[model samples]
Target: LVALPHANAQTDPLPSWNEGAAKKSITDFVARVTTQGGTDFVPVPERIATFDNDGTLWTEQPFYFQLAFAFDRVKATAPRHPEWKTTQPFKALLDNDMKGLAAAGEKGLLQIVAVTHAGMTTEEFARTVLDWTSTARHPRFHRPYTELVYQPMLELLTYLRANGFKTFVVSGGGVEFMRPWMEKVYGIPPEQVVGSSGVVKFQIGASGKPELMKLPKIEFVDDGSGKPVGINRFIGRRPIFAFGNSDGDLQMLQWTAAGEGARFAGLVHHTDAEREYAYDRSSKFGKLDKAWDEAVKRGWLVVDMKQDWKTVFPFEK
Candidate 1:
C-alpha cells in the first residue's frame, strides 16, 4: 500500500490564502521565529504582533466602518437633538449630501465622532457598539459589518496565535469601538486591542454606583506617528511583527522593522476591484500611497488582495 500524507501535514494554516509569495512569506517568517535554536527564533514573551483594523483586517471603502456607525448614531439621536438639522456637517449627513459632508472637512468629521461616541457610560458605549455591529449591515455587501472581515486575515490571526504569538490590534479607529466585539470576532480580548481613544471621567450614577463616562475630549489619536507612541505606552514592548494597510500605519511598521533581530513587517494592498474595492494613493480613507512606497522600498511583504487572497470576506462562498 502506498503511504499517504499525514493528516496534520495536509492541513493548511491559512486556507483562505492562495499558494504564492505572500502566503510563503508569512509561513516562512512564522516558521523561522518559532523554530528552536534558530537564529530567527523569538521567545514567546517577545512574540508580539500588531495589526491595523480598518483596511488591513476589514473593508474600509467608501468610509470607515466606525464612521458609518457614527453617521447612524447621528440619525438615531437626531430626534432628540433637532439642532443637528441646521448644523453644517450634521445637516449634510442628514441630507445624505456626500459633497457637503466632504466640504465640512476633517474638523467636521471629528465633531461627528465626538458627539456620537461620547457622553455616555463606558458600559453603555460598549453595549451600543455591540448592538450596532450585530444589526447594522454594510451598504454594499448587505452583510453585517463584522462579517465583512477578510477571511484570510482571520486565518492569519488564528495561525499566529497558534504559534505562540500575541496579536494586538493597533488601529486608528476608536479603542472603545473595537474593544466591544474584538474578542467575539477576532479572538483578541479587549485589553489587547489598542486604538485612538477619547477622554473619560469617573462619576457616580443615579444609583450611587461609580461609572466611567466617555467624554468628547480626545485623549490619544493612535494613528501615524501616534501608533508607535501608543504601542510604547500601552504594550510596553517593541513588536516582532507588524501588519497594516495605509499611510497611517507607516510609522508603526517602521518601528517594528527598526527593532533588533528578525522582524516581519507587512501590508495589505487592496488591489481587487472585482471582489472588493481597489484603491491606493487617491482614496479618501485608508490611502496606501506612502506606505505602499515604503513597503516597496523596505522589501516588506505586501499581500495583494487580488492575487494573494483566495477569498475576501467570510460570507464569500
Candidate 2:
C-alpha cells in the first residue's frame, strides 16, 4: 500500500503545515472546540467543516480541472457529431484556438458542457469521469490530477476529522463529477459533497433497469450566493468551519462566519510561484479579490501558501 502522508509520529496533526499563525490558529481553534467543558466546546455532530474543492483542496491554475475534462470530452465526442467540426466553439476547440474559444464566452462553454456532460446515464457518466481522471495528467506537473491535491489541505482535513469535525466538500464543481472520486482522493463520501448539478430524470432503460439520465438543463449552481442556498438545502446545517480560495467562495465563507459560536473561515492564498502558483485578485480563474478584502476586514485566516505550507503536493519529497 502507498503510505499516505500523515502527522509526524502523531505528535503534530498537520505536519505538512509550517509553524505560522495560520497553523497555530487551526490548532488553537480545534483545541478550543474539542476541549470538554470549555465554553467554546462544540458537540461532535455540530462540528461541520465545509471546504471548497478546486483551488482549496487542490490546484486550479491555468484552468479548472473539470473544464479540462469538458474539453477532452469535446474531443472524444467530436467524431460522433460531424457538425461540431464546423460549429463556432466546436471548430475553435478542434483547431486549439484558445482565443476563439474564449470569444465564444460563457454561452459557448455552457453549450459544450451541455453536450458533453448530459445525455448519458449517471452510471455511464461516472464511468467516463473515472476513466478520464485515472489517465489524465495536469499539463505542467505531468502528474495525475488526483496527485495534485494539496498535502497541507489533506493534513488539515485529517486533522479536523480527528478532532470530531465532520468534513464536507461544498464546491462549485459538479456533484456527480466529484462524487465518483472524492472518497478515494479526499476521503469524503458522495453524500457529503454538495455541488452544481444539471437536471436528471429517473426512467427505465431498454434493459428495464432504472437509471438517472443526465439532462442538458442546469438545475442549480453552487457558487457565490448559490453556495449558502445549496448548503441550506442539501447539508441541512450551517457550517462552523469553512475553507476556500476564491471570490466565488465568498458567500460560503460569509455564511459560515454568520453562524453562531466558534466559527473559523480561512482562505488559501496562492503565493508560491516557485513551488506551485502565485495568483490572486487578477487571476481569471480562482480570483481572490473581494474575498481577500473581506478576509482582511473580518480577521479571517488568510493562509499564505508559501509561508504556511512546508510541503505543497503529497508527491513532494
The 10-residue segment with the lowest total lDDT in model 2: 1-10
How do the predictions measure up, each by TM-score? 0.96, 0.97
lDDT of 2 by residue, 76-160 (tens): 8888999988998999998999999999999999998998899999999999999999988899999889899999999899999
Candidate 2 residue pairs in clash (backbone atoms < 3 Å): none
lDDT of 1 at 206: 86
Off by over 4 Å in 2: 1-9
Q: Model 2 misses residue 5 by how many Å?
A: 15
| lDDT of the candidates, in the order given | 0.94, 0.94
Q: Candidate 1: count the clashes.
A: 0
Mark the regions of model 1 whose C-alpha exceeds 4 Å error after superposition: 1-10
Query: How much lDDT does candidate 2 score?
Result: 0.94
